[model samples]
Target chain A: MLRELADILQAEELCNTQGDNVQIDIACACDLMSDVLLHAKAQCLLLTGLTTTQSVYTAEVADIKVICFVRGKRPQRDVVELATNKNIILLATHLPMFESCGKLYRNGIKGCSEV
Target chain B: MSEDTTAQVLTAGRVQELVYELKIEDAMVRDVQTVNVESTMDDVRAILREQKISGTPVLCRGELVGIVSIEDLLKALAGGETKTLVREKMSPNVVTLYADEPLVHALNQFARYRYGRFPIIDRKTKKLVGILTKGDIVRCLLRRLEMNHQARERAHYRPGHLFEDVVSDKSTLVLRHRVEGSNFQRAGEASSRLKKNLLSLGLSPDTVRRIAIASYEAEMNIVIFTQGGELVATIEPNQVTIRASDKGPGIPDVELAMQPGYSTAPDWVRELGFGAGMGLPNIKKNTNEMSLDSKVGEGTNLRFTVYTTNPT
Candidate 1:
């Protein structure tokens, strides 16, 4: 995906203090921290409602590149600032939780299917 | 009478009202016994043993001044100084919270600060009235699970069904499922099962983390939004891939959908404590790469990838 397109999909831009030079290919959405720790795919975007520092930590541990916050929820200052320092693309949207995932679905993003 | 419609009607007991009643008060401990600071070492030990308490708040004339735990007493005794005053060995910092605040907030505080116990104080009077223990939170989780089970039973929803394993690897596993929209309760069951499988397969902790986060997020979306859906996961040597595709209402705006604190889940879902608008963001944060594709009316497909590198 084009860098600009990825940024647009996430509806976010790099902060002045950081670089937005990166890429992504898949996405997952969830609120349960335990489930995310267990099932996230590689080289993917994570969508979630959790805004704690641990959420970002989980992302780093999982090696996710982009983070999209669904339902207009904003992360705490520490979370946003932390993502900035970590070079993670953090974006926000006003779409409801499921609709947001649906929006991505309707666009042609294929999942990492076992078949 | 149609059984499907009848079932829907019967199972329509609102989850919102139920969870509203579950608001944090029941999870809080309302009364706590405290000890005087002037109490001798022997007296403090006796109180702890008698009360089966690990720690006690030390008060000076009705004001909390310090805290003396059993560990402190043991250390003092080991040093051959049981006659020392409780005030001398007590820890001064006392973490506290109000009785009426939400239990979730208290739990967050506990996780953030690593506090094993917290004093519940009156916000207006500044008087210690209760104690909040880790045990209290565990009890609350048990209650929540029990209530969820009761709600599921009321809905006549089966716990696990409609999934078949299609692939597996040293680092990943895949499953296929043909899902119907109305059976939302069973949606994340596949992801949950895969997580259990990963544990059984002895996937590294890093690899398991990637797989679990991606799968759960996709599974939850399928359950909540799809009228009917298919789920597929690919486990590669270094990463895991999960996809959920649905033929249902599609998203018109990808930008708005990725925002945090946003949700369209009914009050019922909110009450069930399921939808907090963190699903996608949590998945994104946990994975190394992600992509989203959707359209209005045609259908939706969501995918996730989680990568693992050998930990140092």
Candidate 2:
């Protein structure tokens, strides 16, 4: 069952982040944008804390649906604006990286098939 | 009217309240080392040498403070005398990451910032934990590619599957010879032929694009660089992959070969409007994935892949 992106973002406490309603199936959590670029996984949500235009570029290149910024650190205004323009979801939470990932995992968001 | 109002309200809500949960941390590296800002330059150099390290975090009173590197030491040495002081030369305001952050976050941070390494810290205690380097990220990426290749092989998808539509079962090993260094005016023969064959097979537009880009880049590299080489085009149902292995003098610096704005092509190649140094970059840009293996004085082999889903 597809859940509402806004619901997930709020539950994760990442609500002022960009991705709100975009659908994500699997999760591809990595700090390295290059791996995301080379890895082919569909409908995957990107979990990261990177705040840069390159993160947006990587999302565009890899076709990621959502970005979850961990550690409560928000993206720069330009980054959020870019996501808005691209229709890519951006979300952030205060949870540390491991806990954030675990929260999603417990909720049934698995990594991509190859992970 | 009520439904339209509801739609507008929902849309506005969507804009303000999007959330995301964390996923798996893709890459992890241990044994990252650090130095203290108060340490002497001698100590810094010794630490770097002992660890075989290029960059090190400088800590003060167990708090992340600055970074010191070979560049700093070299700069100090080049400017005047080698100052034994570490605090005087260390780079302040270090960019950092949390220990549990995802690799994608680190990748962006490194790429955008051009940082060689990041000090990983505990969020609450903010204690310095580990360091994530470019090497670690690249390692993760290479591992991912290898895993993907293994999976494809298990699925009976050899690299050659990219050209199955054009080559056919009876014509797999044949290499069509184009003129050696034949320029772009004569560039698209191999590509056009392959494209025609794919078009006849009713390949999707995305597939045709992959084949076209792969073949075009490979063909151009052959014509522009080598004394002469054959153009090989291969196709498969899901992927279009190209291998352009040439006997050109090869790349002196393989890393620079991949970098944009660095090219060894002749003036004539540029005059013909070809060598803008965009050949390899374009190949990399067009393909969904790529890899290069080259040895100086030996040869260069460029491997390019474009999926049917992503196009050429």
Candidate 3:
């Protein structure tokens, strides 16, 4: 599913590893780290616009394995290093957050609560 | 809509609501450690070391009074004040954090104060419910990244598209090479043939590189370990799939052999430094997906795929 999402959004891998087999139980598209912390699952695909070391830290704390930056917002090198150290996959996509979430929802992806 | 208007809407649509809605309670630690105000500096130092913490809030009869840190302890000890009470050394002007406040507010405090941790006070009870640290905030935020990679397992369905027709298709060419055992000098013959084929087809540099690595590794494995094998490379519109099957003493342990540096090659093969046992592992690493099926005596069938235009 992540591969499909990447293809749809024209996403590029900012990090080296690919979680091709990693199961993403839920999909959340939000820039607010607090909301994600409140409602995220252990195996999730994060789609957000915020590109910062704090964003990467927040995702790792929430146990999010894959993070997709929307609207072509790639994380800085330091953020990439932090995510890499934590074994989190980072991708950047041209699609905005709403459209990315909408496509995933249309393709049977759901929020963590629904799953 | 105008391009500028579209951009403005995207930036403006959900700014304020998201900014004010997130609070410190969502990510703060609830169980806070505190030091009593009357405790001696030595006692405070011991607690910090035992807990492996940098600091803690100082409490006096259930009322939050001040905050103390390891730095404070060091400063006191440096001044030869081991007998001084924590009340004398702790920072009395405690910049407390409210759980109900916006997380950004907490972030601002962290930036402004340069403190390692803050004592979080519950809004209604007005008492310390938890400790908020920079590490804690990082952890909480990382935990919230929503990653649901529920990709449907569609195996290599890339038929050429209209626009991509001009660029090229991987399906146009199919090449096969015969590798004979003991042909040490000609071991890389098949791999070079496939490389020439891929390069001639005008494929992407990344795709060509991946195919080259997998094919070369596969070829080396066939020549070094097997009686002989046939190497085949099939190009499809979207990806390249390579299959190499040998007719020799089959690998009894596919998993173990797939590990790097697990070569069962004879002393001669090792002396050649050609079989460092990385062939199979290299093939697996270069390809996006790999499947290996083998029996004790029959043979081994190895297959891998590399996407052409885009990385899978």
Better of 1 and 3 by DockQ: 1
Question: Which ten contiguous residues of candidate 1 chain B have the minimum total lDDT?
Answer: B158-167
Task: Give the i-RMS of model 1 in Å.
Answer: 8.6
Q: What is the RMSD of candidate 2? A: 28.3
| Candidate 2 residue B130 C-alpha distance from true site, Å | 66
Q: Candidate 2 - CAPRI tier?
A: incorrect
Q: How much is B142 displaced in model 3, in angstroms?
A: 62
| Candidate number that wins on lDDT, 1 or 3 | 3
Per-residue lDDT for B182-298 in model 3, tens only? 776555557656765665565665567567667766776787778898998877666888889998678888889877677777877654434567777767766888999888788
Candidate 3, residue A16: Cα displacement in angstroms equals 36
Candidate 3 Cα errors over 4 Å, as ranges: A1-115, B1-172, B310-312
Instruction: Output per-candidate TM-scores for chain A, rounded to 2 decimals.
Output: 0.79, 0.79, 0.90
Q: Going through the candidates in order, what is chain B's TM-score?
A: 0.42, 0.41, 0.45
Among all windows of 10 consecutive residues in model 2 chain B, the one with the lowest summed lDDT is B15-24
